[model samples]
Target chain A: MNYPIIVDVTLREGIADPEGATIERALPALGFNGISHVRAGKSFRMNIDAEDESSALAIAAALAQRLLSNPVIENATARSAAKG
Target chain B: MTRIGVVVFPGSNCEYDALGAVSALGAEAEFVWHSATHLDGFDGVILPGGFAHGDYLRPGALARFSPVMEAVAEFARAGGAVLGICNGFQVLTEAGLLPGALQKNRGLTFLCQPTTLTVESTASVLTRDAFRGQELVIPINHFSGSYTCDDETWASLVAHDQIVLRYKENPNGSRDDIAGVSNVEGNVVGLMPHPERAMSTLLGSADGRVLLESFVGAPVGAR
Candidate 1:
């Protein structure tokens, strides 16, 4: 089975992002108006193949721990469905 | 002895990792509290990446004003070795120790992958021993890793061979494929990826040893 993983790096609502702040300042001038709070982050998609759904999921979790995400700044997981 | 100092601010968790890496080379790694204002006796200083001041006012903005940063600035002015990794790189830029800023990923998400990096400069202590354009896989764990800078500085960076590391393939949409950079003096180096994460094959690739070893030109197997 193949599994999909998604990682989100956005700061929590209360968290501060200076990069986002800089981007926010430029948005109004770039013709993007009425938009508030632009936060920046990245994502990685990995298809892990295992014998079954449980195994696939386990691999995804291990990947997340070993290489796929920064545990401190991010919250990530694997999806049993392909949409993940 | 090459005394190295790792600045530890509120959100800096990688200080120990960097210390372990530096200590592997027989260099003693000292943890300097962010509030400290003096850096009088170290040969090298590294601002390992993390959310400093809780990532307030920008990644390194608040940290740039840290009392210790004054020492960092002074040390660099005297031609000292400085390496900033991930968030540390962000801080260096925020402090104007390096040019440009780290923007959000082009994909608008956080990417954590074992990315391949190309050696872009040999003149730098960070990349000197590696073959020109050598490729190494290191983990990139960040949201704001994209590097953006204007033209004049870009041209000078290219002309001076100050660009130290480049993505093997453009991953973050970093301008000019830049993954790392050095100051004009080639002593201060900052890169967006985590070389410390790839120090051993157990994690992924041991090639990081080569990259880290270039700092002191000898290997002690630390990361």
Candidate 2:
């Protein structure tokens, strides 16, 4: 069976997010209000040939941890696409 | 003559510059395509500056998986000297041959200019000829050059004397003004500056020759 998966990669807490901070800074000048703590990240979607959803999530989470996101500076989460 | 291999990824633009710089120092320099799986004839390997694999998915992230990297890893494991400059540094970190990661510059701006660096340690093949506290002027060109590592890694770096160079004045907000670093064994070194571009005073500074010469002159076997 093929299970669809999505991996979200984000900078770990305490790491600087210059791109997100820059966007947030510009938002105030653009008349947008009440927005803060912006962060930037990358997402990857894929289909895994696994027997079940749990196996699919495990495969995706491994991929995310090893390749999609660097553990040194980023955090990654993998989930079933159908759930979202 | 010492023979050096310069790994050339699909998008690498600094292979020729690295070749020229090493050749100018009387070393035989050759380009090793990223797919080559063996570095049999090279005494040292250099991963030069440039956007490898078009800097896709972050600089060096994709290129870290190239076949040549396997050979590079084996070479580094055997204590053969390996040097990574600029984008090459990013690849080293991605490959787990070095610690820390390069992030977008703090100001979110691309930087390209000369930078002054102080020699923090001469324990690595790249800086063994220079005296501690000696300064070198090199050029840096990058959009993402800020170096970040966790507190424990920072402590280990300090304790092991793995930090090889530090910017005389912080340029891109790198932690502790770090400009270059080496692995615990000191055979593998990576730096954000372009030493190959500083080969001659006519081009701005010849101090880069000091570092390159040190690399080329390292003992031929495991350290």
Candidate 3:
């Protein structure tokens, strides 16, 4: 199955988001109500074909290590979904 | 027979390009892991680009204490020619081989874009074969490249022609548009761009060759 998976690397929960802080300052009267905390992150979407979910997850992990992201500031995971 | 060494830390990503550029110009480049202690005799050293140690604390902050940097600091003190590219530049500063700190870009973004740089001083070892004020197009990929220095340091850099490369348009909010700088002795040089990445038009423009070629193009002792 060919499906797209995304990896988002932003600050974890309870972490201060400077980027979010800047955006929140402008959101009060701009029609974005009830939006409290906002953070930014890198997104990666790719298609992979694997015999099983484990193999697909393994591939994702390897890609993340090799080039998909910088492991220092970024945390990542492997998520797979079957296409209809 | 000019032997060059490319220092490789745990997270360095541009050693391959540095080796390629050196080998393409008919020199031998050996990879020196950051864990090593001593830098054996070599013609020159190129601290090629990459996010060394992941820039965890600060760009080059932790990398300064790496074992191999001791040798690099000694080599520069002895007047060996060294050039740091991008993160390599940060490491050099952290190691105290050069001065100043590279802070987060004022724009607060991971800027990866093609940039323009002007050759500020042709008299330095890295640009002695070229004409000053020559502008070249190259690529810059960095998050914390804003160069910060005190009033005295900035004045000295300007007075001694220590700046060899200045950005044509100040891409990183660096002080005085400093794309690259050299030491007072002209033996150590560092810049915040990837010259090796732009050595060929196939990768992109070959304008960077003008700078990288300077390392191997001339005699060892002359500036």
Number of the top lDDT candidate = 2
Comparing only chain B with the true structure, the TM-scores of all models are 0.94, 0.98, 0.96
Candidate 3 off by > 4 Å: A1-84, B218-221
Question: Interface RMSD (Å) of model 2?
Answer: 0.6
The CAPRI class of candidate 3 is incorrect
Compose the digit string of candidate 1's lDDT tens values, residues A1-84. Answer: 566655334443433456677788889899999988787665556677778877877777776654443332334566555653
Per-residue lDDT tens digits for candidate 3, residues B7-94, read 9999999899889988888777899999988777788888888888888756887787888888988888777778898999888887
Prediction-by-prediction clash tally = 8, 0, 0
List lDDT for all candidates, in order: 0.78, 0.94, 0.78
TM, every model: 0.71, 0.97, 0.73
Better of 2 and 3 by TM-score: 2
Give per-residue CA lDDT, model 1, range B1-223, as digits (tens): 7788899988998888888987886787799998898887777888998899887544676777788888888888877778899999988887788887776677567888988988978877688678887999988989888887767778989998889999988888788999999888788889988887887787788777776777755222211
- Higher-lDDT candidate among 1 and 2? 2
By TM-score, the better pick of 1 and 3 is 3
Question: Would you list the rank order by TM-score, best first?
Answer: 2, 3, 1
- Candidate 2, residues B64-125, lDDT tens digits: the string is 99999999999999889999999999999999999999999988989999999999999999
